[model samples]
Target chain A: MDTQGTFRQTVEPALVRRLQRGELAAFETIYRRFERAAWTLALRLTGRADVAQEVLQDAMLKAFERARQFRGDAPFAAWLRKLVVNEALMQLRHDRLHVIELFDETHADDDAPAPWAHADSATLDRALNRLPDAARAVLWLYHVEGYTHLEIAEQFGRSTSFSKSQLARATKRLRELLAPQAEDTPCTIGSTTTA
Target chain B: MHDRLDHHRMTGDASLAAALRALPASTPARDAWPELASRIRRRRVVRKAVWFTLPAAFAAGMALTLAWPHLQRSTASPAPVRVAMQSSSHATPPAAPDIDALQASSQQWQAWVQTLDRDGAPLDGRQLTQAVALQDRIGLVDLQLSAARNPSTTVGLWQQRITLLQQLGLLHLQPYLVATQRPASHDHLISM
Candidate 1:
């Protein structure tokens, strides 16, 4: 189901061509190029630094080993990103990360709205971290990551309604989290600088 | 003020997504290149091993396919083996272990397991699957025990039943003891 495109959509045909030849240097070049992006995506989805590290390593290894299977219709970055996403999701399933985090339902909200536009980056980041892993994954996948509800439902092995519900609840939780400081901070929705 | 609030509200969802997209990207504290390189090398090694071994395995299978009928024809028919198999059901070992102790031990373990399970502690999927399998094995032994004609066979079946019960008991008991930090029993039934 995820075979469509779980990868980041960045095209470099020459690099991909070299990659299909199984060149070690090309593999390393791609890794260096997207290491931060892939790692960031994995970390946000998994919410654990150690798990994200493993996901990055495993995703890179998988991409390198299976490079010959690249069809070239999509960008090499997207295929690699798919591997990273799959690896991160596998870790979540293996550890049942969301089950442990779901024990506390006090922060869950089903009818809440997303007022995150007014929250500063630091406050929003903190609140995002505090959201349960599943809800956060749903929110990120649906909103920023350009994942379809159907795709997300397939990834999580749930109904599309499940994805919709999680996003709704996650937005509500974010609203509640930022409610106390909503009036204090003026936030920017612009691009972030490289860390 | 009302007009401004309405404008922000209309674009709230889009701005929220843009805000999410703009959240900072982070680099992990540790570099993963060494581990990744090692994994790549290890996988290549495995792939090479498979490539080397696969043809040899295929040749072996082909050779066996060619030789199997001749081997079968040349060898004498295994009438003795068939007879032995037929007679195995009624045969019993000479010295049967004590059925009383086995039955008693099995009962005790079963009682302990039942009591523990009745307390309503959660069992994860793996442990629960194992428990189900152990019970199935015990049921099989019970079936054999019922059909047994000889005391030796009955005693052997009872021994199997007790061993299975012990394993099933441990499946439930291990978690409880670990949770409670109680000392565990390392030895089998003491008397027998």
Candidate 2:
């Protein structure tokens, strides 16, 4: 669509260039486009909407401060997501109990509708939320943010073994959560799919 | 049996992954953008101004100090030196109604005021006055020493005055001293 093409052109190249020059207007534009994505990630990581709001502001401020260093080689969205994630983790450390409480609530409310009840992929969301911070971060970066395990380890200041172990643990836990849901869905008699 | 186990694992993992993908996307709250922008702008201005002025201020101070030898040897009459010292020393004292009452204020109390400022703690107006009086005392002595016939004593007085001036410079940057100078460190930023 023309709208999609226009957004790509007007948003990416010009936006990156303007941000590189420290233009507030350009930053506002980027914020408007990506604020929801950043906030969602923050909320998921921290659980509380208030903490998410703080993370959003803190992340954007950091992004603006370091905007000059951002090379346009990576998509701005991915870079922004990483910043949001880092800020959320930093906030978690500061508050200490914020993420832990969220994790506990998620696990305790197994009977309650999953947090991502509105999504077609609700089961996966529940599984990811139940993960430990380090593991959850790796999974989100890998699947959602589209980073390689090697890249995730480098960003996390951990070795590749740690990154892989986290991913393995996340996958194992996800499988356990998804098994019940999978069983509940009645198998169609005419379905050719083996599972 | 192996094939069945593989199917169960793969399908379950995929389902969980999809659910994870589906966690509701959140929109950023509206109020944060402007506040963050303001903070960034404030920090940038403070850092840049500090960098530029800190070096220049240090350089000018060192140049003046280095020129001390030449200026001292040039045996001008005491009249010109007296006039310069008087002009520089003309800073008005605190306009407290009870100047005499404050004159007897202990130097220890005044030093506490200075210490509070150095530690980035707030001081009361009375304490501020005491600190100012102490600074004035040092400055006056330095001016007098500059005009003195005794060279060794003059050097000692100037050194003491410089130390006081350095303290004032650091204090000027404190948040409480917003009405004064905005602290932007350049050369000896860490020391300041």
Candidate 3:
């Protein structure tokens, strides 16, 4: 599928203009187009489907209210994604769920290959879900969302080292969780064979 | 040995990252549009109400503040001539031309009130109460002005009374102004 073409089709300038004029129908169109992607990102950030839904609604409303300010400098989808991230962070802050670890002491052991390196997406998602809020957020932003450590730090109001340390600890814990499963399954199929 | 370990870790990290990136974006179980639309509409209504109510409240507050001193002055000075003059002004035309002028002014006030009731915008409960209170205050100041022994004090009091009457008229007309002069964008709020 042509992903770029699909994205371009969803947020046409004409639709954006209509939304800027406070057209409810245009807003509904944008919501329908991006709701799944928004909800998924929100769910990942917040770790709760209910809270994710709330975040999606709030973020979309804010986007609609400030639609006039959108200068079309970036794709509307990207802007909306950023807004969802911001909303999710705000929800986390409000709930006091974002706990930042002060030190990288927990994952100081020798670097080891993640045992479940060859695990399917479901197992990986489960492992991700088990991570602490800050760790999960850092990993998602850094590895998945392509946010730089500095950007992650800015979002979380922490230093870049804070993002780095949280990511290290999260990766370590995920490896440990997947190690047991790796022991059961031989590292034969597409495994990073260790010497 | 260190280089081999680093290679293995890098491969593992790449594999893990791929799995995460492959995670499918899931659709929500329910449609959020209905709730979202309702919320947006409710917010617009609240904004419009605030836009209208604040100015009306301010006008009423200003009228009360301006009328308060005159109301107090009227009650303090119990002038018998003022009472007699007010009574004669309402009941009959005074023989004196100046007294007749006072009677005409009083009649004009009655006509103004009638015109406001007929032509002005309908008042909400709060505005109606303020208008009534202001009318009562105006009556008290009128009595006080009629009884003033000093011509200068009478003139000042008359001016204050006229200002109060104008304010009271505005207070009565405020709801109409809010309804008619509202911006077109606010129409969505009412329609919703």
Candidate 4:
């Protein structure tokens, strides 16, 4: 239902002005409003709740400091999201935790249905969390965050093919992990579910 | 056949992407506000401390710069002046031509420094340290000029003093200059 657009509309100009004026209450309001989304993005990127919490706090503080730089041209949520993403990337780099696997050149059989096609969101989330840091990050950025391959490549300091390959590998691995369970379950009645 | 299969794969991938996008943002396990608020408070306090401390340091540096020459002059025996006068007895004393000028120049710079000390209430820590070091150098140069043995040496030292004074004046006037150039905007608070 155009959730992102609706979320952007919720942040009133008056509220932003209050935040710009260094009002703690205004900042707190912003924090409560977006903290969950920020935390989720962080968790997806970092794959650890502890690290995600740290990234969330750091990014929120940075947002508070740079609030005056918010030109009001972009959605406040988008701006905050950028900060969170940057912070999560920085934290990952600082921790030296990036684990990029070489993309396997062999393609998976295209006719095979994706096991995760009908998996519950929670199950999908757990499977995503199992991915290597780099694969998960690329997957999240490309799919969930709506960043293009070029954008993901730029963010990761890699080539577009690198992003493409990482996404492929991630999706392949996720499907493999879910396929066995899907085959065992009696609910696998149709070949229509692909993802 | 390959084209149709690729299309089917694309559709499946698109559905997967949609599902991923639709996943709800999970709530953090604990409330992050109390800690976040404390961090913001701590940062504000640190910023305020820096703001207050920096100007005070700049003022102290200005004071030291202004008072340094006088302190040095008071401590030294007039032996250097006596020696210079005795050494150049055949010619006009090197000190006679430049001492008054030097003292006046020093006083002028001192006045400028005092004005800055009064006004430089917003100088940051780095700027204050720079001002202090510049002032100390000026005092050292003044001492060197006062001890010059020849007219040539005195002229060089006088030139050095003028240059140093020019720099010190610029350094001292920095805060006022910056303030005038950029009328305080709300954006300034954001940087801190």
Candidate 5:
């Protein structure tokens, strides 16, 4: 995860090799290396440092306990990230309501034409905040973790269809919120990133 | 504008992830590493002692019981002669201070056992009973160990406790841990 300097060029590959050979030092190094990455993800998702700490610690301990099961087909970081996300979601579920609902019944927007959108960063942030917790979680998992809908569904304890619906709805809401700032050419469909 | 949206999502997500990753790591209530390793060593020692002394203890007790009848039949005429023979043949080595220490420790253990009977929680259900038994057995070993004065005995008891804890799935209780944010990955994509 932390592929900085010598870790990427030398330490990482060596550690992986040692891990494959079942060496203790390798395990220690790996723990130390990715500890920060794991902690960060947990903190952001949980929105509390204390909860994040708990989740991260739990994830690492589990990883070590199940280290033997690590089939190297996927990078260790990916597996570790999945574990962290699951932990974060579990914490969230415990803290709040299970199913989240988001709707604006007053404004159907069916008759109105889609407007240009180029909202300020603050406005976009608020729009993201306005999304339901479940949708926010899906967006983070997809846009951040880069997980597929099926993976998100599996990890987040929802159906794949639910995951797809959440993402589509989130993107749609974001577009509408930022519509006032749209450029003359307009924000291209399926080109949310390319200006 | 489109590029800006993409940038917004990317940076916003990263910053959020970065914030999330900053959470501190917590130490589990019970660290399984030292406990596990120590338990493994203790079990090995216990097994070794059990392997050696069990058969011998059984055989010695049986031999004494079988000879009891024969000794009773010869008791009248040769009682003093038999006593002298027994004294010579069965006399153990001189009492060592370690044995005395062991005895004292066993007495302490007896007190602890009495306390458990008096104050320890009643383990009602079957599983609970087994858990209690596992812990109690460990305590019993400590008691036996104080009187036994054999270092090996202590090791054996420790090992047995470890085995029980392992079987109970207590060792794997803390499976997950903490870490920092991971960079977003780009690989396979699925649409459903």
Candidate 6:
């Protein structure tokens, strides 16, 4: 991920043209550049290694086939990310796993500082996977991917309210998942709550 | 390029978002490239066949359609006009290449070379020098063709122009051909 910023500066519009003309070498260079980001996003969104790998492949193939449609209005990375998100969401829809039920986390604090701030990636990753597909997807798309509520709504074919609700529920659920316990388990990260 | 919404504005999700952003990029356990490459090759082959076959089939169908009435007329009545047409066609026997066809092909190749160059086709230093020399030669042929010249001399110059154009085009095309052949190793990607 640290390496991506330097490479991103080098992705000229000419490279996009080469990709539009179906140059495999151009595409290969691009794949090597963004492979990690694409794979990571795929894994986070789908919460399954196999599905994430397949999504990455399908997203890349779509990027190749639809290169002509890239009007250069957005950065190529953003366009590719959109493709990954679309494919992963489509996979969720197909699997019927992206249901957004209101998570009843009444015990979760609404005002307290986020206990998850210091939680390690592995801890957050495990907790994130426990979320309902829709809520988790909305949260990731909203907070991490930097998608707007309207954009998230459009992608999921839901209302902005639906996006807002899912994000709130997912956030509350994560707080509970990371809330303080009687003893710090081996995998337990720092807790923000006072005993 | 995303217009990042204010996660800070959204009820204390800032810490959560920061943590997510801090997560390291992940990679597959095994390289997923070989399978992707095989799929790309298959798609390329299918696309190439379609591109070739569509124009060919269209041309064949058009030729048949245009020839149908002529065929029926000749069979219905072998008129004197038919004999005259047959005699005239036979008179133009296959000793020389058609000048007009050669000129058309030369123009198309010249256009192709120019397009590739405009698209920044990768030609190394030596190849670039050769391309410039070839283009100069083709320009010289055009200048000579405009002078007082016999039919044979004009044909010869046009043929020379076409040959030069083909050389330049092939030079411009070499990088793409090499790429399509698929390198045995991608260690060079590190350099790229």
How do the predictions measure up, each by TM-score? 0.59, 0.59, 0.64, 0.66, 0.43, 0.58
lDDT of 6 by residue, A113-168 (tens): 67667566667777787788888888999988888999888777779988888888
- Report the Cα lDDT for candidate 3: 0.69
Spell out the clash pairs found in candidate 3: none
Runs in model 2 with CA error above 4 Å?
A: A1-10, A48-51, A89-131, A171-195, B1-8, B64-149, B171-192
Candidate topping TM-score = 4
Docking class of 6: incorrect
Report the C-alpha displacement of residue A6, candidate 2, in angstroms: 17
Give the native contact fraction of candidate 4: 0.50
Measured on C-alpha atoms, candidate 1 has an lDDT of 0.67
Q: Which of candidates 3 and 5 is the stronger one according to DockQ?
A: 3
* RMSD to truth, every model: 16.2, 12.2, 11.0, 10.2, 14.2, 15.5
How high is the lDDT of residue B105 in model 2?
A: 25
Per-residue lDDT for A99 in model 4? 52
| Candidate 1 collision pairs | A7-A78, A7-A82, A8-A78
Candidate topping lDDT: 4
Better structure of 2 and 3 per lDDT? 3
lDDT of 6 at B159: 62
Fnat for the candidates in order: 0.59, 0.41, 0.47, 0.50, 0.01, 0.43
| Stretches of candidate 4 exceeding 4 Å from the true structure | A1-9, A185-195, B62-192
Clash pairs detected, candidate 2? A121-B18, A121-B19, A124-B16, A124-B19, A124-B20, A125-B19, A125-B20, B50-B184
What does the lDDT read for residue A75 in candidate 4? 81
Q: How are the candidates ranked when ordered by DockQ, highest leading?
A: 1, 4, 3, 2, 6, 5
**What is the Cα-based lDDT of residue B166 in candidate 4?**
62
User: Model 4 misses residue B74 by how many Å?
Assistant: 5.5
lDDT of 5 by residue, B1-192 (tens): 778666765555454444322223322233334543443344444444444433543443354346435433433335467556657887533233333433443344334334333433343466466657666776676677567643334434434443443433221111110112232231111101
Error of 3 at B167 (Å): 21
The parts of candidate 5 lying over 4 Å away from their true place are: A1-13, A17-25, A97-99, A105-131, A172-195, B1-192
> For residues B1-192, could you state the per-residue lDDT of candidate 6 as single tens digits?
122334433436677788877766677776787888888887675456445534643453465446445434434434566556656786523213355655665676676667657653468898888888887887888999899244445666766786686677668767656544533332221110
The candidate 6 chain A region of ten consecutive residues with least summed lDDT is: A186-195
User: Candidate 1 chain B: minimum summed lDDT over ten consecutive residues — where?
Assistant: B183-192
